[model samples]
Target: MNKDQVKGRIEEAKGKMKEVAGKVSGDKKLEREGKIQNISGKVQAGIGDLKEDIKDAI
Candidate 1:
């Protein structure tokens, strides 16, 4: 996978960890931040996937 995909996946993992930690610690703000980060990572990964698809199609 491309750099974006790799990075995004890493971010997604990190966000998930943060979300879990936040829940366990009872931090709503951290939980929300983690959710946002997770979403952002998914978007980045999707963009990377689209780029790869286009490249392969060519």
Candidate 2:
């Protein structure tokens, strides 16, 4: 995958960890941040997939 995809995956994983940690520690802010990070990662990954699709079509 391209850089965006790779980075997005990493961010998604990190976000998951953060969310779990926050839940264990009772920190709503961290949990919210994690949710945001996960969303951003998904968006980035979608962009990467689109890029690949376009390349293949061409």
Candidate 3:
């Protein structure tokens, strides 16, 4: 995978962990941070996917 894809996946996984930890520990701020991270990861991954698609098309 490209850098964006790899980083996105890592971020997504980390966010998921944080989200679970927040829920377990009753930390709303952590949960929110996790959600934002997850969204950012998804966006990054989408960009990576688009790049790959364009490369293939070309």
Clashes of each: 0, 0, 0
Off by over 4 Å in 1: none
lDDT by residue for model 2 over 1-58, one digit each (tens)?
A: 7888898888898898889989999999999999899889989988998898888899
lDDT agreement with native, every candidate: 0.89, 0.89, 0.89
- Which stretches of candidate 3 lie above 4 Å from their native place? none
Give me the displacement of residue 18 in model 3, in angstroms. Answer: 0.7
Clashing pairs in 2: none
TM-score, model 3 to reference: 0.95
Candidate 1, 1-58: lDDT as tens digits = 8988998898898888889889999999999889988888898899889889998999
Instruction: In angstroms, give how far residue 23 of model 1 lies from its true place.
Output: 0.6
Clashing pairs in 3: none
Off by over 4 Å in 2: none
1 or 3, which is superior by lDDT?
A: 3
**Model 1 Cα RMSD, 1 decimal:** 0.6
